[model samples]
Target chain A: MPKGVPERGSIPDDGLTTRQRRQQPVLAIHTGTGKGKSTAAFGMAMRAWNQGFDIGVFQFVKSAKWRVGEETALRALGDAHLASGIGGPVEWHKMGEGWSWIRKHGDDADHAEAAREGWAEIARRLASERHRFYLLDEFTYPLKWGWIEVSEVVEALRARPGNQHVVITGRDAPPELIAAADLVTEMTKIKHPMDAGRKGQRGIEW
Target chain B: MPKGVPERGSIPDDGLTTRQRRQQPVLAIHTGTGKGKSTAAFGMAMRAWNQGFDIGVFQFVKSAKWRVGEETALRALGDAHLASGIGGPVEWHKMGEGWSWIRKHGDDADHAEAAREGWAEIARRLASERHRFYLLDEFTYPLKWGWIEVSEVVEALRARPGNQHVVITGRDAPPELIAAADLVTEMTKIKHPMDAGRKGQRGIEW
Candidate 1:
């Protein structure tokens, strides 16, 4: 192994050294009509945080049902890093607020503008390499709802600066984004307790 | 809704009250060949931890190449909980030690015995409600290899005590476990950068 980089047993002749291959950016997405898509992306963020990578979590959802616990834990982790200088900094940004599954009140026009602004800010960050790991949680919804262009988002990710890794999580991801991704995983639902009248518990759901 | 529990719009008339339904335990599995199975389970563990649930992570594997970072972050979270009285306690146990992907060691018989013992221990804990959230990481291997009985594991999970939520992660899960699970998500791979000669990166992979 050159410079302690695992050769991965086989490598295509892409004219890039193993080190270069190791340093390449990762563009991935978690998509499907199932749960754990965003959870897995958050899980990757935890690993990235452990490795001292600057983390940026952008939530682009039409509604917020049960993600409070996740935010609290990640924020605590971020504070721990800031206090002890163990891990890198973490920044969490929500594109839209007050959109609820049970009670919806936010105006669509305002949310659309906010979503556009969020996408623009993410695009700027990608260009400047602001964060090593960018987690765009529930991002496909805006694209699905026609509030953001999937092509533009893909182009920005494809041209991201440095070794930044981007992971997007949502359902019904556009084919263009899927085709452009280096890795994509669809969380297919086989069964759910909600089908059996089991209500969401506070700890498990959030 | 009754007592602020979300009714979920549709609930089958299973004779259980909304409160009882809210108290029902969840049995879930994250399976398939794609990535994010373990990551999603870890993500759920973080959520469970945030909600003040005692977490127990049991790792059953034939090889351990990475995963050092995950253990570190979770342990730090555990320590913070004890120090600050926030979140919950965490117990992480690895069944097999010195088993490596690069250099495989340890006798098969020993590992099988250890896995059996580990399963037995989990069964005991589930019966006793030792932990509020049980994470059986990569536990399908032992069941797949017949070192542990899938049916017995399913029975234990189905008959688990209290409000414990159990999530198992691995590839090629047994059909019995799948049938017994309330939630199952198969991570289907759409694309991978490794196919294009991309080696694993430290901050992302670990």
Candidate 2:
């Protein structure tokens, strides 16, 4: 167990029984200036996928052109499940304005609209319980930039039905969103390769 | 890209060319009061596995009996790679004193000795470059607790030959170790399920 983490039995009473607590879904936030925020969320998604949790990943900042290693692996896992009926469904959606968006729309308004559309889709999924695990990668940026309302996002998450687990990853996550989350991890940066004049490498960064 | 991360072209010069910088190995430290430190390392291992980099994992705190989901997945990948010759070799070693060790040794001296042995084995591997990527999971505790000398570790890592990338995970990592590392990410806890009176659940923690 990690240091400073209280044992389950030792945790102070919150007026909830073990069964009641077990039934509660997690709203985890991964926000910080360091690396691994998104990677860590992807790791959890992998575990959830292993447990037959239908997973939905909505990317907010990353471009559609950049294919991350996790996406490739998880998509393959989802395909294998489709072929052999072993695991769960996995869907990935990229909401950022990449080169394609620039070529087509060439406006910031289009990017903002894309972000809003992504959140609406997620809201719909949450209402219908379409996915057991939802990863809102870099979703905090849109809220910070005022493209999405923090209140609406919080309300949707709080009212999200069933046992759906949601994970949000980004830097500078709003105080309201952090308050709404059950679990939040801030990745503090002590050092980075770029500090030593190195660029992000394939496999390590992607 | 993550907020505040310098783009490749914008990275400041550190007197090394791109090729020279790429050749240098990375010594990354993941530490702090939050979860996903180890999970993030496991994700990197997954990426390395995909790139066919020979990987070695040494767990210092977690027991051999505790089967983490990442271990299961990576081991499965390793097995598949071995069967198909698609990837590189993968080795995992647990050096912690589990239930059996407590039953037999039942002393701090034994635990300290085990930590020393684990470090010695890793040092030997570093010298020979047995693995391209080495994950020393939960290794910070030994240094913090004085079971292993931080200076010796720093020296070994500094002198470690080849382009071997090392990632160490645990909380309260020593300042000396952090200073020696090329990249350090501190996982700060903003909130947790345990804070909400929830225990570690399957497909989330393990």
Candidate 3:
């Protein structure tokens, strides 16, 4: 009704009241060839964390060795939550080499297996309502690379019970997942610092 | 050279080495019709805060009446930083009606003046290196509304000294601003809950 607000019913008929809609879980996907997909998801994670949502972070591509700043801050918040009982649980898992199973048997097949295992774990968590908010960082690659099937992932996500929110971030997300998601954002690159021969810097990239 | 990696020299010859590039200030613009532009900037601010960078957040469009989750978390971090000397200073300012000055003198001309004043304060901070990281949230709106001049903002940003990092977020960013920025990302909307008649939700929109 407002000048800037989108026209009424421009938001398609989802056949739910505002209250009913608020109760429904959200599946948000951030995909594009820009820099902030994961970062934006992490920001949402921060908001969810502050609201006392149990948060799970599953990193698919970032090396465990790479110390991301948001991870550290959020992990600290998690620790504080545990100590003070102010917030909910926070769990961070790296599906790359850092995963114990993959670490035990390192190889290409193991990497693919590890991705499957990671998906399985997430599905388990989703079924059990393990976390209210899940950040699947750089997850689209698994689907794109065929390490994980998009259809299966979509099925699991759709079947996820309760009000669990999931955010998947990466470039070139599979179309099925995009179709399945309730919210999808594509971070298109207009220009990049690397275009000027600049590398990622601390506190900016991480 | 690699499949995913940009080709050698694809990053233009800025004549800046890794160290030099790292030391150079960053002007990042996040603009698009999609969500997460401000959220991504806040994520970077969190990273900057964790890295002991003095952080300043200037809100241009968001109502001061609305309390954002990032502001709360960051202000808390700022307090901890002050008490424990672990991180750096964090200052949050609202240049909207919530501002005492603007509230005291409410008018269209005053609103325009307030925008100018906000820019002037930022310019002053830039000159003095008041903060290492600045999040100019919803900043592009003022420029778009002609409350602030594009050339002036670009000039101020370009003339900024030191390694101070600034992230400006808003939709429909002026072409001049994009040209001046070293990094720019347009958050294109693929799908949104609002498209399905859902309003902003807690821990997601805020």
Question: Which candidate tops lDDT?
Answer: 1
Q: Where does model 2 exceed 4 Å of error?
A: A2-16, A62-67, A79-87, A96-109, B2-15, B62-67, B83-89, B97-109
For all candidates, state DockQ relative to the true structure. 0.45, 0.39, 0.49
- Candidate 3: deviation at residue B102, Å? 9.5
In the range B88-126, model 3's lDDT, one tens digit per residue, is 678898876444333464543467778788888889989
Q: lDDT for every model?
A: 0.81, 0.78, 0.80
* TM-score list, all predictions: 0.90, 0.85, 0.90
lDDT of 1 by residue, B68-134 (tens): 6677778878988998988999988776673222155456558888888788888988999999999
Displacement of residue A93 (Cα, Å) in model 1 is: 0.8
Instruction: Let me know the DockQ for model 1.
Output: 0.45
Off by over 4 Å in 3: A1-15, A65-67, A83-87, A100-109, B1-15, B65-67, B97-109
lDDT of 2 at B159: 97
lDDT tens per residue, model 2, B1-206: 53335544575657776667556788989898788898788778777776688999998874643336666556655765676665556788777543222245444347778888789989998999999999999899989899999999999999999889999999999999998988899998877778645766556665
Identify the candidate with maximal DockQ: 3
RMSD of each: 5.2, 4.4, 3.3
